[model samples]
Target: MKIGIISDIHGNSEAINSVLKNIKEVDEFICLGDIVGYGADPNYCIEKIKDIKCRCIGGNHDFAVAGKVNINYFNYAARSAILWTSLPLKKENLNFLSNLKRRIELEDNVFAVHGSPQDPLLEYILDKDTASFIFSKFNFKICFVGHSHLAGCFSFSENNNQVNYMNFSNGGCIEINTNKRYIINCGSVGQPRDGNPKASYGIYDLKNKAVNIYRVSYPINLTKSKIINAGLPRSLADRLSYGR
Candidate 1:
Protein backbone atom coordinates (compact mmCIF):
# COMPACT_ATOMS: atom_id res chain seq x y z
CA MET A 1 0.00 0.00 0.00
CA LYS A 2 1.26 3.46 -0.84
CA ILE A 3 0.45 5.78 2.04
CA GLY A 4 0.91 9.53 1.99
CA ILE A 5 2.17 10.98 5.27
CA ILE A 6 1.53 14.59 6.27
CA SER A 7 1.91 16.53 9.48
CA ASP A 8 1.80 19.93 11.14
CA ILE A 9 -0.44 21.43 8.51
CA HIS A 10 -1.06 24.42 10.76
CA GLY A 11 -4.07 25.59 8.73
CA ASN A 12 -2.21 26.51 5.54
CA SER A 13 -4.82 25.39 3.06
CA GLU A 14 -2.72 26.51 0.12
CA ALA A 15 0.23 24.31 1.02
CA ILE A 16 -2.03 21.36 1.73
CA ASN A 17 -3.78 21.80 -1.58
CA SER A 18 -0.49 21.99 -3.41
CA VAL A 19 0.73 18.81 -1.79
CA LEU A 20 -2.56 17.05 -2.55
CA LYS A 21 -2.29 18.08 -6.17
CA ASN A 22 1.29 16.90 -6.46
CA ILE A 23 0.78 13.52 -4.86
CA LYS A 24 -2.35 12.24 -6.51
CA GLU A 25 -2.14 8.44 -6.52
CA VAL A 26 -1.54 7.44 -2.93
CA ASP A 27 -3.80 4.71 -1.57
CA GLU A 28 -4.13 6.20 1.92
CA PHE A 29 -3.09 9.34 3.80
CA ILE A 30 -1.75 9.34 7.35
CA CYS A 31 -1.64 12.74 9.00
CA LEU A 32 0.46 13.39 12.12
CA GLY A 33 -1.51 16.49 13.14
CA ASP A 34 -1.56 20.21 13.96
CA ILE A 35 -4.49 20.45 11.57
CA VAL A 36 -5.73 23.71 13.04
CA GLY A 37 -3.05 26.06 14.24
CA TYR A 38 -0.36 28.56 13.11
CA GLY A 39 -1.97 29.80 9.94
CA ALA A 40 -5.30 30.74 8.34
CA ASP A 41 -8.30 28.63 7.21
CA PRO A 42 -8.74 26.11 10.03
CA ASN A 43 -12.19 25.02 8.90
CA TYR A 44 -11.18 24.91 5.25
CA CYS A 45 -8.13 22.82 5.96
CA ILE A 46 -10.12 20.44 8.17
CA GLU A 47 -12.76 20.02 5.47
CA LYS A 48 -10.10 19.35 2.87
CA ILE A 49 -8.40 16.70 4.95
CA LYS A 50 -11.73 15.01 5.57
CA ASP A 51 -12.57 15.13 1.90
CA ILE A 52 -9.31 13.37 1.10
CA LYS A 53 -10.04 10.66 3.68
CA CYS A 54 -6.91 11.10 5.80
CA ARG A 55 -6.18 9.16 8.97
CA CYS A 56 -4.82 11.61 11.52
CA ILE A 57 -3.82 12.06 15.15
CA GLY A 58 -4.13 14.99 17.50
CA GLY A 59 -1.25 17.51 17.68
CA ASN A 60 -0.30 19.82 20.51
CA HIS A 61 -1.88 22.70 18.69
CA ASP A 62 -5.00 20.66 18.09
CA PHE A 63 -5.25 19.92 21.77
CA ALA A 64 -4.88 23.57 22.61
CA VAL A 65 -7.51 24.57 20.10
CA ALA A 66 -9.94 22.02 21.52
CA GLY A 67 -9.44 23.53 24.99
CA LYS A 68 -8.10 20.21 26.23
CA VAL A 69 -4.81 21.92 27.10
CA ASN A 70 -3.73 25.39 28.09
CA ILE A 71 -2.28 27.52 25.29
CA ASN A 72 -0.04 29.42 27.67
CA TYR A 73 2.61 26.79 27.14
CA PHE A 74 2.90 27.74 23.49
CA ASN A 75 5.29 30.32 22.09
CA TYR A 76 4.08 33.71 20.96
CA ALA A 77 3.55 32.75 17.32
CA ALA A 78 1.89 29.46 18.20
CA ARG A 79 -0.27 31.11 20.84
CA SER A 80 -1.60 33.51 18.25
CA ALA A 81 -2.46 30.69 15.89
CA ILE A 82 -4.05 28.61 18.64
CA LEU A 83 -6.24 31.49 19.71
CA TRP A 84 -7.30 32.09 16.12
CA THR A 85 -8.05 28.41 15.57
CA SER A 86 -10.09 28.19 18.76
CA LEU A 87 -12.31 31.02 17.68
CA PRO A 88 -13.15 29.91 14.12
CA LEU A 89 -13.14 26.10 14.10
CA LYS A 90 -16.58 24.79 13.28
CA LYS A 91 -18.31 22.62 15.87
CA GLU A 92 -17.86 19.52 13.73
CA ASN A 93 -14.17 20.24 13.19
CA LEU A 94 -13.69 20.85 16.89
CA ASN A 95 -15.28 17.48 17.58
CA PHE A 96 -13.01 15.86 15.06
CA LEU A 97 -9.93 17.35 16.65
CA SER A 98 -11.15 16.32 20.08
CA ASN A 99 -11.69 12.74 18.93
CA LEU A 100 -8.25 12.32 17.36
CA LYS A 101 -5.88 9.87 18.92
CA ARG A 102 -2.33 10.67 20.06
CA ARG A 103 -0.79 7.81 18.15
CA ILE A 104 -1.59 4.99 15.74
CA GLU A 105 -0.02 1.68 14.84
CA LEU A 106 -0.14 0.89 11.17
CA GLU A 107 -0.99 -2.56 9.93
CA ASP A 108 2.57 -3.30 8.82
CA ASN A 109 4.17 -2.80 12.24
CA VAL A 110 4.88 0.87 11.70
CA PHE A 111 3.78 3.48 14.24
CA ALA A 112 2.72 7.12 13.82
CA VAL A 113 2.78 9.94 16.32
CA HIS A 114 2.55 13.71 16.29
CA GLY A 115 5.72 14.20 18.29
CA SER A 116 7.60 11.27 19.81
CA PRO A 117 6.77 7.79 21.02
CA GLN A 118 7.33 8.68 24.67
CA ASP A 119 5.19 11.84 24.66
CA PRO A 120 3.11 12.28 21.53
CA LEU A 121 2.46 15.97 22.02
CA LEU A 122 5.47 17.06 24.03
CA GLU A 123 8.78 15.38 23.14
CA TYR A 124 10.86 15.78 20.02
CA ILE A 125 13.05 12.91 18.77
CA LEU A 126 15.70 15.09 17.15
CA ASP A 127 18.97 13.63 18.37
CA LYS A 128 20.42 10.16 18.05
CA ASP A 129 20.41 9.69 21.82
CA THR A 130 16.70 10.47 21.98
CA ALA A 131 16.07 8.24 18.98
CA SER A 132 17.99 5.40 20.59
CA PHE A 133 16.00 5.86 23.78
CA ILE A 134 12.73 5.74 21.86
CA PHE A 135 13.86 2.66 19.93
CA SER A 136 14.03 0.72 23.18
CA LYS A 137 10.41 1.48 24.08
CA PHE A 138 8.68 0.22 20.93
CA ASN A 139 8.95 -3.09 19.14
CA PHE A 140 7.72 -1.76 15.83
CA LYS A 141 9.99 -1.92 12.79
CA ILE A 142 9.50 1.77 12.11
CA CYS A 143 8.09 4.82 13.88
CA PHE A 144 6.95 7.82 11.88
CA VAL A 145 6.67 11.12 13.71
CA GLY A 146 6.31 14.80 12.89
CA HIS A 147 6.62 17.88 15.13
CA SER A 148 10.09 19.18 14.51
CA HIS A 149 8.89 20.01 11.01
CA LEU A 150 12.10 18.70 9.49
CA ALA A 151 12.35 15.94 6.92
CA GLY A 152 14.88 13.46 8.22
CA CYS A 153 15.41 9.85 9.24
CA PHE A 154 17.10 8.20 12.19
CA SER A 155 17.95 4.57 11.88
CA PHE A 156 19.29 2.18 14.51
CA SER A 157 21.25 -0.61 12.96
CA GLU A 158 20.84 -3.77 14.96
CA ASN A 159 24.16 -5.02 13.58
CA ASN A 160 26.25 -2.24 15.12
CA ASN A 161 23.62 -0.95 17.54
CA GLN A 162 24.33 2.52 16.19
CA VAL A 163 22.01 5.37 15.31
CA ASN A 164 22.44 7.47 12.16
CA TYR A 165 20.59 10.41 10.70
CA MET A 166 19.93 11.42 7.08
CA ASN A 167 18.10 14.40 5.61
CA PHE A 168 16.24 14.03 2.35
CA SER A 169 16.14 17.01 0.01
CA ASN A 170 14.50 15.63 -3.13
CA GLY A 171 11.59 13.22 -3.08
CA GLY A 172 12.57 9.61 -3.66
CA CYS A 173 11.95 6.12 -2.37
CA ILE A 174 13.96 4.51 0.42
CA GLU A 175 13.97 0.80 0.96
CA ILE A 176 13.60 -0.29 4.57
CA ASN A 177 15.85 -3.02 5.83
CA THR A 178 14.20 -5.49 8.09
CA ASN A 179 17.43 -6.00 10.05
CA LYS A 180 17.36 -2.39 11.19
CA ARG A 181 14.72 -0.14 12.75
CA TYR A 182 13.86 3.37 11.64
CA ILE A 183 12.34 6.54 13.10
CA ILE A 184 11.25 8.80 10.28
CA ASN A 185 10.05 12.38 10.51
CA CYS A 186 7.71 13.10 7.57
CA GLY A 187 8.07 16.84 8.13
CA SER A 188 5.54 19.68 7.99
CA VAL A 189 3.10 20.14 5.18
CA GLY A 190 2.20 23.76 5.87
CA GLN A 191 5.17 25.05 7.83
CA PRO A 192 8.69 23.79 7.26
CA ARG A 193 11.48 24.86 9.61
CA ASP A 194 14.59 23.19 8.24
CA GLY A 195 15.51 26.39 6.44
CA ASN A 196 13.51 25.37 3.40
CA PRO A 197 10.57 27.51 2.35
CA LYS A 198 8.71 24.79 0.52
CA ALA A 199 6.14 22.53 2.15
CA SER A 200 7.25 18.98 2.97
CA TYR A 201 5.60 15.54 3.36
CA GLY A 202 6.33 11.90 2.59
CA ILE A 203 5.05 8.72 1.01
CA TYR A 204 5.48 5.29 2.54
CA ASP A 205 5.14 2.29 0.27
CA LEU A 206 4.44 -0.47 2.72
CA LYS A 207 4.74 -3.31 0.26
CA ASN A 208 8.26 -2.35 -0.69
CA LYS A 209 9.08 -0.93 2.74
CA ALA A 210 10.14 2.33 1.13
CA VAL A 211 9.64 5.99 2.04
CA ASN A 212 9.80 9.08 -0.17
CA ILE A 213 10.18 12.59 1.18
CA TYR A 214 8.47 15.12 -1.05
CA ARG A 215 8.51 18.90 -1.12
CA VAL A 216 6.31 21.22 -3.13
CA SER A 217 6.17 24.94 -3.68
CA TYR A 218 3.04 26.77 -2.65
CA PRO A 219 1.79 30.36 -2.46
CA ILE A 220 3.44 31.45 0.74
CA ASN A 221 2.34 35.02 0.22
CA LEU A 222 -1.27 33.99 -0.03
CA THR A 223 -1.09 32.12 3.24
CA LYS A 224 0.73 35.04 4.83
CA SER A 225 -1.93 37.48 3.70
CA LYS A 226 -4.65 35.24 5.07
CA ILE A 227 -2.83 34.93 8.38
CA ILE A 228 -2.56 38.70 8.63
CA ASN A 229 -6.15 39.23 7.57
CA ALA A 230 -7.39 36.75 10.16
CA GLY A 231 -5.88 38.90 12.92
CA LEU A 232 -3.25 36.30 13.69
CA PRO A 233 0.28 37.35 14.60
CA ARG A 234 2.24 38.85 11.74
CA SER A 235 5.25 36.78 12.74
CA LEU A 236 3.29 33.66 11.92
CA ALA A 237 2.89 34.95 8.39
CA ASP A 238 6.44 36.27 8.12
CA ARG A 239 8.05 32.98 9.12
CA LEU A 240 6.65 30.99 6.20
CA SER A 241 9.09 32.40 3.68
CA TYR A 242 12.02 31.93 6.02
CA GLY A 243 10.90 28.44 7.10
CA ARG A 244 11.94 29.20 10.69
Candidate 2:
Protein backbone atom coordinates (compact mmCIF):
# COMPACT_ATOMS: atom_id res chain seq x y z
CA MET A 1 0.00 0.00 0.00
CA LYS A 2 1.19 3.49 -0.70
CA ILE A 3 0.37 5.98 2.03
CA GLY A 4 0.69 9.70 1.43
CA ILE A 5 2.30 11.22 4.50
CA ILE A 6 1.83 14.92 5.09
CA SER A 7 2.74 17.17 7.96
CA ASP A 8 2.28 20.71 9.18
CA ILE A 9 -0.40 21.84 6.77
CA HIS A 10 -0.50 25.09 8.78
CA GLY A 11 -3.78 26.31 7.28
CA ASN A 12 -2.44 27.02 3.80
CA SER A 13 -5.28 25.83 1.60
CA GLU A 14 -3.45 26.32 -1.65
CA ALA A 15 -0.46 24.29 -0.56
CA ILE A 16 -2.65 21.55 0.89
CA ASN A 17 -4.87 21.48 -2.18
CA SER A 18 -1.89 21.15 -4.46
CA VAL A 19 -0.41 18.40 -2.33
CA LEU A 20 -3.69 16.51 -2.21
CA LYS A 21 -4.13 16.78 -5.95
CA ASN A 22 -0.59 15.60 -6.56
CA ILE A 23 -0.73 12.70 -4.12
CA LYS A 24 -4.31 11.65 -4.80
CA GLU A 25 -3.20 8.37 -6.29
CA VAL A 26 -1.92 7.04 -2.99
CA ASP A 27 -4.02 4.41 -1.24
CA GLU A 28 -4.36 6.41 1.94
CA PHE A 29 -3.28 9.65 3.62
CA ILE A 30 -1.84 10.32 7.05
CA CYS A 31 -1.49 13.80 8.47
CA LEU A 32 1.10 14.69 11.09
CA GLY A 33 -0.85 17.82 12.07
CA ASP A 34 -0.24 21.55 12.57
CA ILE A 35 -3.38 21.80 10.40
CA VAL A 36 -4.57 25.07 11.82
CA GLY A 37 -1.86 27.63 12.29
CA TYR A 38 0.40 30.04 10.36
CA GLY A 39 -1.79 30.27 7.29
CA ALA A 40 -5.21 31.60 6.32
CA ASP A 41 -7.51 28.60 6.06
CA PRO A 42 -8.02 26.55 9.19
CA ASN A 43 -11.59 25.43 8.57
CA TYR A 44 -11.01 24.78 4.91
CA CYS A 45 -7.95 22.68 5.61
CA ILE A 46 -9.69 20.77 8.37
CA GLU A 47 -12.68 20.05 6.18
CA LYS A 48 -10.50 18.97 3.31
CA ILE A 49 -8.47 16.60 5.49
CA LYS A 50 -11.66 15.16 6.87
CA ASP A 51 -13.21 14.90 3.44
CA ILE A 52 -10.33 12.72 2.31
CA LYS A 53 -10.45 10.60 5.45
CA CYS A 54 -6.87 11.46 6.35
CA ARG A 55 -5.79 10.03 9.68
CA CYS A 56 -4.52 12.94 11.74
CA ILE A 57 -2.59 13.68 14.89
CA GLY A 58 -2.83 16.87 16.90
CA GLY A 59 -0.09 19.47 16.43
CA ASN A 60 0.90 22.25 18.84
CA HIS A 61 -0.84 24.90 16.81
CA ASP A 62 -3.89 22.72 16.31
CA PHE A 63 -4.16 22.21 20.03
CA ALA A 64 -3.64 25.88 20.70
CA VAL A 65 -6.42 26.86 18.34
CA ALA A 66 -8.67 24.20 19.82
CA GLY A 67 -8.11 25.65 23.28
CA LYS A 68 -6.23 22.61 24.45
CA VAL A 69 -2.89 24.43 24.59
CA ASN A 70 -2.05 27.82 26.01
CA ILE A 71 -1.80 30.57 23.41
CA ASN A 72 1.20 31.88 25.33
CA TYR A 73 3.11 28.86 24.15
CA PHE A 74 3.32 30.52 20.73
CA ASN A 75 5.10 33.71 19.73
CA TYR A 76 3.48 36.99 18.78
CA ALA A 77 2.61 36.15 15.17
CA ALA A 78 1.74 32.58 15.95
CA ARG A 79 -0.40 33.54 18.92
CA SER A 80 -2.21 36.08 16.80
CA ALA A 81 -2.74 33.54 14.07
CA ILE A 82 -3.95 31.04 16.60
CA LEU A 83 -6.49 33.53 17.91
CA TRP A 84 -7.57 34.44 14.41
CA THR A 85 -7.76 30.80 13.36
CA SER A 86 -9.84 29.89 16.38
CA LEU A 87 -12.53 32.45 15.68
CA PRO A 88 -13.39 31.12 12.24
CA LEU A 89 -13.14 27.39 13.00
CA LYS A 90 -16.32 25.42 13.18
CA LYS A 91 -17.13 23.86 16.53
CA GLU A 92 -16.86 20.45 14.94
CA ASN A 93 -13.42 21.23 13.64
CA LEU A 94 -12.32 22.44 17.05
CA ASN A 95 -13.67 19.24 18.54
CA PHE A 96 -11.84 17.26 15.94
CA LEU A 97 -8.56 18.93 16.80
CA SER A 98 -9.21 18.70 20.49
CA ASN A 99 -9.80 14.98 20.33
CA LEU A 100 -6.92 14.09 18.03
CA LYS A 101 -4.31 11.72 19.35
CA ARG A 102 -0.71 12.77 19.70
CA ARG A 103 0.53 9.40 18.46
CA ILE A 104 -0.82 6.65 16.29
CA GLU A 105 0.51 3.25 15.30
CA LEU A 106 0.03 1.78 11.87
CA GLU A 107 0.67 -1.63 10.40
CA ASP A 108 4.21 -2.78 9.51
CA ASN A 109 5.73 -1.40 12.68
CA VAL A 110 5.16 2.14 11.52
CA PHE A 111 4.32 4.90 13.98
CA ALA A 112 3.14 8.46 13.39
CA VAL A 113 3.32 11.57 15.53
CA HIS A 114 3.11 15.30 15.11
CA GLY A 115 6.36 15.72 16.97
CA SER A 116 8.88 13.33 18.56
CA PRO A 117 7.55 10.17 20.14
CA GLN A 118 8.69 11.34 23.57
CA ASP A 119 6.58 14.49 23.44
CA PRO A 120 4.34 14.18 20.45
CA LEU A 121 2.81 17.62 20.66
CA LEU A 122 5.88 19.73 21.38
CA GLU A 123 9.31 18.15 20.92
CA TYR A 124 11.37 18.77 17.78
CA ILE A 125 13.73 15.85 17.18
CA LEU A 126 16.22 17.76 15.05
CA ASP A 127 19.60 16.30 16.00
CA LYS A 128 21.42 12.98 16.03
CA ASP A 129 21.56 13.01 19.83
CA THR A 130 17.85 13.64 20.18
CA ALA A 131 17.09 11.03 17.55
CA SER A 132 19.33 8.53 19.31
CA PHE A 133 17.60 9.14 22.62
CA ILE A 134 14.17 8.97 20.97
CA PHE A 135 15.09 5.68 19.33
CA SER A 136 15.15 4.02 22.73
CA LYS A 137 11.70 5.37 23.56
CA PHE A 138 9.82 3.80 20.68
CA ASN A 139 9.99 0.25 19.43
CA PHE A 140 8.56 0.89 15.99
CA LYS A 141 10.91 0.21 13.14
CA ILE A 142 9.84 3.48 11.55
CA CYS A 143 8.47 6.51 13.34
CA PHE A 144 7.20 9.32 11.11
CA VAL A 145 7.24 12.78 12.63
CA GLY A 146 6.61 16.38 11.63
CA HIS A 147 7.11 19.69 13.44
CA SER A 148 10.66 20.61 12.52
CA HIS A 149 9.31 21.42 9.03
CA LEU A 150 12.40 19.80 7.51
CA ALA A 151 12.27 16.84 5.20
CA GLY A 152 14.72 14.23 6.45
CA CYS A 153 15.22 11.01 8.31
CA PHE A 154 17.37 9.64 11.12
CA SER A 155 18.32 6.01 10.99
CA PHE A 156 19.82 4.07 13.89
CA SER A 157 21.72 0.85 13.28
CA GLU A 158 21.82 -1.43 16.23
CA ASN A 159 24.73 -3.33 14.82
CA ASN A 160 26.95 -0.30 14.46
CA ASN A 161 25.42 1.62 17.40
CA GLN A 162 25.19 4.59 15.10
CA VAL A 163 22.57 7.14 14.18
CA ASN A 164 22.78 8.91 10.86
CA TYR A 165 20.77 11.87 9.60
CA MET A 166 20.02 12.30 5.92
CA ASN A 167 18.64 15.53 4.49
CA PHE A 168 15.89 15.13 1.94
CA SER A 169 15.44 18.86 1.69
CA ASN A 170 15.33 18.61 -2.07
CA GLY A 171 13.25 15.41 -1.95
CA GLY A 172 14.39 11.84 -2.60
CA CYS A 173 13.65 8.22 -1.79
CA ILE A 174 15.21 5.93 0.82
CA GLU A 175 14.82 2.22 1.20
CA ILE A 176 14.02 1.09 4.70
CA ASN A 177 16.62 -1.24 6.18
CA THR A 178 15.23 -3.83 8.53
CA ASN A 179 18.37 -3.71 10.65
CA LYS A 180 18.05 0.03 11.20
CA ARG A 181 15.21 1.94 12.87
CA TYR A 182 14.10 5.27 11.47
CA ILE A 183 12.60 8.61 12.39
CA ILE A 184 11.26 10.28 9.26
CA ASN A 185 10.06 13.83 8.76
CA CYS A 186 7.96 14.49 5.65
CA GLY A 187 8.49 18.25 6.00
CA SER A 188 5.64 20.75 5.77
CA VAL A 189 2.97 21.37 3.20
CA GLY A 190 2.29 24.94 4.21
CA GLN A 191 5.24 26.20 6.20
CA PRO A 192 8.44 24.54 5.04
CA ARG A 193 11.54 25.63 7.00
CA ASP A 194 14.31 23.78 5.21
CA GLY A 195 14.92 26.73 2.89
CA ASN A 196 12.81 25.14 0.17
CA PRO A 197 9.76 27.11 -0.82
CA LYS A 198 7.98 24.24 -2.50
CA ALA A 199 5.37 22.26 -0.65
CA SER A 200 6.70 18.95 0.68
CA TYR A 201 5.19 15.52 1.31
CA GLY A 202 6.10 11.83 1.39
CA ILE A 203 4.87 8.62 -0.16
CA TYR A 204 5.54 5.53 1.92
CA ASP A 205 5.31 2.36 -0.12
CA LEU A 206 4.93 -0.68 2.05
CA LYS A 207 5.31 -3.20 -0.75
CA ASN A 208 8.57 -1.62 -1.93
CA LYS A 209 9.79 -0.77 1.57
CA ALA A 210 10.74 2.72 0.52
CA VAL A 211 9.82 6.26 1.53
CA ASN A 212 9.84 8.91 -1.17
CA ILE A 213 9.94 12.57 -0.33
CA TYR A 214 8.53 14.97 -2.87
CA ARG A 215 8.34 18.72 -3.42
CA VAL A 216 5.84 20.50 -5.61
CA SER A 217 5.08 24.10 -6.51
CA TYR A 218 1.85 25.66 -5.35
CA PRO A 219 0.22 29.09 -5.62
CA ILE A 220 2.13 30.90 -2.89
CA ASN A 221 1.01 34.31 -3.99
CA LEU A 222 -2.62 33.30 -3.64
CA THR A 223 -2.01 32.10 -0.09
CA LYS A 224 -0.09 35.24 0.75
CA SER A 225 -2.88 37.43 -0.56
CA LYS A 226 -5.41 35.52 1.52
CA ILE A 227 -3.24 35.90 4.61
CA ILE A 228 -3.00 39.61 4.08
CA ASN A 229 -6.71 39.98 3.33
CA ALA A 230 -7.61 37.91 6.38
CA GLY A 231 -5.68 40.26 8.64
CA LEU A 232 -3.08 37.66 9.60
CA PRO A 233 0.47 38.63 10.37
CA ARG A 234 2.33 40.14 7.43
CA SER A 235 5.46 38.21 8.30
CA LEU A 236 3.57 34.96 8.07
CA ALA A 237 2.64 35.77 4.49
CA ASP A 238 6.14 37.03 3.70
CA ARG A 239 7.88 33.93 5.05
CA LEU A 240 5.97 31.75 2.60
CA SER A 241 8.09 33.18 -0.17
CA TYR A 242 11.37 32.27 1.55
CA GLY A 243 10.27 28.94 3.11
CA ARG A 244 12.07 29.99 6.32
Candidate that would win on TM-score: 2
Which tens-of-lDDT digit does each residue in 168-191 have in candidate 2?
989999899879999999899999
How does each model score on lDDT? Answer: 0.88, 0.92
TM-score of each: 0.97, 0.98
Question: Model 1: per-residue lDDT, tens digit, 80-109?
Answer: 778878887789999999999998878767
List candidate 1 segments past 4 Å from native.
Answer: none
- lDDT score for residue 117 of model 2: 80
Looking at model 2, report the run of 10 residues with the lowest lDDT sum: 101-110
True lDDT of residue 19, candidate 1? 91
RMSD of each: 1.1, 1.0
The Cα error of candidate 2 at residue 147, in Å, is: 0.7
Error of 2 at 117 (Å): 0.9
Deviation (Å) of 40 in candidate 2: 0.8
